[model samples]
Target: MTAVRIEREIERKYDAAADFALPDLTGLPGALGEPEVQRLDATYFDTTDLRLAARGITLRRRTGGTDAGWHLKFPVGRGVKEEIRLPLGRAAKTVPKELAGLVRAYTRGRALRPIARIETTRTLRRLLDAQGNPLAEIADDAVTGQALDRTEPVAWHELEVELTAGEPGLLDLLDERVRAAGASPAGSGSKLLRLLDHR
Candidate 1:
């Protein structure tokens, strides 16, 4: 059995155009490093009625990238979430019992199944302090998602800034820069919810 690790995630999302460019942040408290690109494919699971999504919770099994595994996220508040992660192991197309049990309160014995598939081409840049310590990660994602009930896929571009070892002002500063770069705040809570057209 793999041990589950939980952490608090503080991040913000924004909607961008296909040709959007990142704003310059090298002159902030830290410098922005060269971008690292990764391709990420994730399949979200939920009951047919989307019980988990209704409550602002998400479960997905993802491959590729540095953190490929099963992830369960619960909304803690605006721009904050409690995330639980488990190793990929050998599981495929089947939700791990450990993760499923964690969301049983919402599932109420309902069967869980794949509801959406989202693929992302991510360009990641690290904001680093003078000592080379990471302050935050800026992810520019080009995403395509297919909902179980939809015949065609939806595509969009978004920016995500996740805090690492930075103060709250770091997020506020980035937000100003991102908005000035022509990216608006994301309309949906997540890719899955947006794809599934939950709200």
Candidate 2:
């Protein structure tokens, strides 16, 4: 079975150290709640020359957390993208044809192969409004990335804040809190891009 998700996916990434943590967000429209931990493992695929990535499209098969599945994402605008999901079928590590078709125009008949794999241990927190309605999710992650072409693995820490239900201004408010916590914006385009570039 398959499911489609159309979210604005407005998010920002910041580099972190091992002992990184979040600052007080209670001052914003939504207050930060307790943290919940989830593990995410995603194997990214693309043609040898990375045609999909060249166009800001990313395809990955991931396991862990509530949204574990095959996710195909393409950029729609700044900080926004479209994601399509399909079940991790019975096949062993294979890309679904349906998803492949969607990106066929960009792929131009090239083969999709696993190029990089990233594993992240994430701590998540929900941002809630005055009435306890959820507004956003803030995630702090420790990451390990390995490129199939390279033998060494790269390790890093980062933070990501994703909006669930809230006005766009909430994102900017939360952004201020993160920046004040001694964290800086990410130096790469995406997790997969970071891995491929290092290798």
Candidate 3:
């Protein structure tokens, strides 16, 4: 079994217009880094009956980023989740045993299968303190999603600000600034759930 790593994710999402630009965040307590671009592709898995989705548990295999691998996220609270990650070791189209075992309570012996695929073109920037410590990361995403049903694919633009080494209050401060610039709070909790039209 490969090593399993755990992390806490605290982030917020926003829906953006087709022409939305990232607002000036330098006015806050940190310095903004140069923007980096990445193309990310991910496939989300769930039981046919959608048991995991109902419980807010997500398992996905993703590639094309610094953290490319298999990720299983469990909701802890609003805007908070505990993420378990494992390396991708030639197991395309297959969920790793370690990750599967973690969600067995919800899966209840049912099989997990690919339910949706999401492709993202991401422009990422980091918010750093005067000391050069990372405070948070802002992602501007152009996303396309399609369910396994093979129906029409949907696409949209969204923004995310995730805490790295920052305090929780930083989110609230950014929230006001981001909204003043015209982005609305995300109507959906996650990209997968939005893709599956759960919310």
Clash totals in order: 0, 0, 0
Task: Write candidate 1's Cα lDDT for 143-181 as tens digits.
Answer: 999987778889989999999999989999999999999
Q: What is the lDDT of residue 187 in candidate 3?
A: 86
The residue-by-residue lDDT of candidate 3 on 137-189, one tens digit each, is 99999999998876889999999999999888999988987898899999888
Residue 118 shift from truth in candidate 1, angstroms:
0.3
Question: What is each predicted model's overall lDDT from 0 to 1?
Answer: 0.91, 0.84, 0.90
| Range of the 10 consecutive residues with the lowest summed lDDT in candidate 2 | 1-10
- What candidate 3 gets wrong by more than 4 Å, as runs, is none
Off by over 4 Å in 1: none
TM-scores for every predicted model: 0.97, 0.93, 0.96
By lDDT, the better pick of 1 and 3 is 1
State the lDDT of candidate 2 residue by residue for 1-199, as single tens digits. Answer: 4555655577777787788768876667777788789999999989998998888789999999888888888888776777788877775467889888998898889999998999999999998888988798888989999988889999988888788888888888878888888788888658887777786
Better of 1 and 2 by lDDT: 1
